[model samples]
Target chain A: MHPIGTVHYLVLSVALLLIGTFGVLTRRNIVVILMSIELILNAANINLIAFSRAVDNVNGQVFAIFVIAVAVAEAAVGLGILIALFRNKETVLADEVDLLKW
Target chain B: MSQFYTSTDHFVLLPAIMLAIFGCAVLLLDFLFPEPKQRKVLALLVLAGLFFSGIGLWRQYSFLTSQGISEITAFRGTLTVDSFALFFNGIFIAVAALVAIVSYRYLELEGEHRGEYYGLILLAQTGMYFLATGTDLVTLFVGLETMALSFYILVGFLRGDKRSNEAAIKYLLLGAFSSGFLIYGFSLLYGISGSTKLRDIGAAIVSRDLWDPLVFMGLTATTVGLLFKISAVPFHMWAPDAYEGAPTTVTAYLAVGSKAASLAFLMRMFLGPFWNMKEIWEPMLIVIAVASMTLGNLAAITQNNVKRLLAYSSVSHAGYMLLGLIAGNETGIKGMMVYILVYTFMTLGAFLVVVGLRRMDVIGDDVDDLSGLMYKSPGYAVLMLIFMLSLAGIPPTAGFIGKYFIFLSLIQTGHYVLAVIATLYVAVAIYYYFRIVRSMFIADLVDKAPLASSVGLRVGLYITGALTLAIGVYPEPFLRMAQVSFGR
Candidate 1:
């Protein structure tokens, strides 16, 4: 097999990005949707790290670290909001949370 | 690292640093006070923070002007202190201050008055400062997340309301999703240029072919992300619900402050790295501009909820602002600055009226709730009328000046078709805006209670209404300000 390279990483990351986008669009479960968002973020992180290596630069890797930190903060906030929502609605289905719709 | 920072960096960053300090101070002081009556002191402290921040911004502006330079790069060129940032920062401070003032009584009425609310406002303003000034992708991304996270919490500040919680979740999910798109694009940009600086990226992009797949993907992804933040058509599903569910005070802030900050970010990205790629993105933005206006105005006609109606109108306003960007001339850029400033005040004034209608027992968000407002509060009703007229871009209001400049820029650029289409939508907008006016004057009262007026709310209304009229009647000073700010 050919050695894994930048293009391989790009292809893999693109797959993850597509899967994440599809999940976000189609999923009815809010928790699952949040996970899909995480996947998309991870996809970016992979792209950043791979590109950093390809370019012989550290800025992309630094950005990836930031992305990971931000992802954690985002997940914390997302779960907190989810708990708040669940407490009120007694359900986690996206379709059921429709109070503000026109 | 020592060489990376200097006194100039601290001086340039003073406003944002002050915001952070004051934000923390407010949070700490809240625990100490813990009394509803004493919370007003927190509001005063918040205002003090904004006042100092404004002073810092002014100092920066005057210093730059005196030096005969338009911009100064701080933090090794990661942050740019320029007329553009100063102008947008002024808008952010004004929006935050107004929201803080009006929020006091509204929050108290809802029994959710807390120190964290004011603290979050300050912190969010701090984030906006970075968005206006940051020249690096890292700084911009961090700043965006800071502002957006604060908003997510603020939107759900009223935990007792199920709608608020639901709105927060929806916003958080969608917001994070969009950031994913943005980061992906940013990563591509980093790979293409091997640097995070916008200048370097611009240099790299200028040498590439127009049909380069990487550049096209980066542009498309970045455009989607920024458009989502601005709540343009097709990406605006979160705005109406979030606006309807959030506290009215927060809704106003979300509508004006957040949109302004995102527009700043958009302008930075487009005018910096993507300037040479205009040919590729201009057609795409034109389509979005038309779709946003058409869909925004048309959908607003049917919205019975005032908040949702304003949300859609804000979307259409986004469309109008995009026309300025699409024109991409000095006049077009100035038009955008003028429009953003005008929009901040008029939109805030309109929401202030809605905030006044809120009482302990009244939801006051439905269109029918505005019935007989003329009889209940003639002064407020008249103020609302001026705001409606301004929003519809009628002459003798600030909004008219904004629209005029935009249309003029479009015509100057030979986009007469766009200019005419925009004018046609003004007529459609007038119809819905007048719907509220008709309900206020011609319809009978559903309730005889006076509006829930407070000192802070009255102050906010007066400032916004007066500015709305002042800018409309004598726009010379404001025009000069916009001209100076766009000089760079």
Candidate 2:
């Protein structure tokens, strides 16, 4: 059996990123879109950590830590906006939140 | 793995540090006061913070010049202080101050004069300062997020307004989605170069001869995020709705301050790290610029909402600025910087006039709302005419000077076809921009009521209007300033 390498990690990361991108484009529910965004970020985290170990440098790991912290802030803000929308229009679907469309 | 810094390094960071502290102070004071009328005090505090930061920035700029130090990279090259950053720092401070002044009357009119509005603007400006000055990918991403998160809340500040909430949600989702692309791209970039410092990455790529497919892919993905931030075409779907739905003052800040900061980051990364790969990236930018100009102008012609029209106009302006980057020379870069400064005034002044009309009887954001504006408020009509003509890139306004520099660089670089295409789009731009002026001056009056604009709104409008004309008439000083900015 082949041991895991940078290539394997990169492949996994790309696959997850593609999945998240698909969810963002296809899903109508805002919650699902938010989840997809999280998935996309986590995929980046996996790549960062993998490269940190592979390159014998901690910079990638440090970047991953910052990414995680920002993700938390982003999640809080996203949900807050989601709740605000739900309160006003009684919907969580992106299609329904279309009052300001050109 | 701790890094040490000297006192001078702290001095270098004074402006951003001052902005952050003042932001929190504004929030605390607002909480203590907690009255609608008292919100004006909070706005004043925010302005004072911005004022002091501007002073700090000026002192820093003089210190750098007097010391004869061209650039200083502190924290292991994570942050940089230089003339380029100082130029943007001035724009950010001015934009923040103007936004605060305009917000005072806007919040009062909406009867939602919360302290957080002012606090959030300061925080966002702080983030902008970092984005402009940061030298490392880590600093850049964190700064971008800080600004993005603040904008998310500010866009939805009017909780009772459905449009504002929708705008906030859309902006938040799209913004977060782009962050994912941005971070993944950063990871890949780090993976390739084994460093997060932009200079180190550029060095690594050059030393290793790493112009493989993966490197190109990583660069492309990273640019996608920056492109979205600047609202370039194919990535600008969120801007129109977000701009229209946001409070008009916040919309102005978004169109001016936030976009300028993003362009600062983009130029630093591309021209600094990716300069060696100019052959690849330049073509991509050219394509994006062309599409943005064509689509933005065509779309603006159909918009009835003035805010939406301005949003699309902002997109086209982004395209024009990109022309400078594609020029890949000193003249082009200077053109980009100058155009941003001029745009800050023209866009902000136009929005202030709209805010002025959002009074007791009229919300003057619709194109039709300006019908017979010369009768109701001749002063405002004339000011709006200056902004509209400037936006259309007519002469005798700063906008023309800005566009002239951009076109000069394009022609100098032999991008004649792109220049011609852009010129035709300028014609389309005039039709729509003049539509507003025609409605106000040429069209018949619908209402004879006098518009009541507050003193704050008047101050904001007059200052920006005066600056627009002053820069246009005497372009020499500004042109020299832009020339001196790059230190080349």
Q: Best candidate per DockQ, number?
A: 2
For each candidate, report its DockQ versus the true two-chain complex: 0.87, 0.93
The TM-score obtained by chain A of candidate 1 when compared with the true chain A:
0.96
Every candidate's lDDT: 0.93, 0.90
Q: Candidates' TM-scores?
A: 0.99, 0.98
lDDT tens readout by residue for model 2, B1-488: 23486766676788898899999999887778866876778878988898888888888888888999888777878888888898898889888888888787778777678888889999999899999999899999999999999999988888999999999999999999998999999898898888999988888667655468768878888999999999999899989988998888999999999999999999898888888888888889999999999999999999999999999999999999999999978888999989999999999999888887787656679998888899878999999999998888898998998999889888999989988998999999999999999999988888777776677788889999998998899999888878878763
Q: How many angstroms is residue B456 displaced in model 2 relative to the true structure, after the best TM-score fit?
A: 1.6
The segments of candidate 2 whose C-alpha lies over 4 angstroms from its true place after superposition are B1-3, B208-210
Candidate 2 displacement at residue A39 in angstroms: 0.9
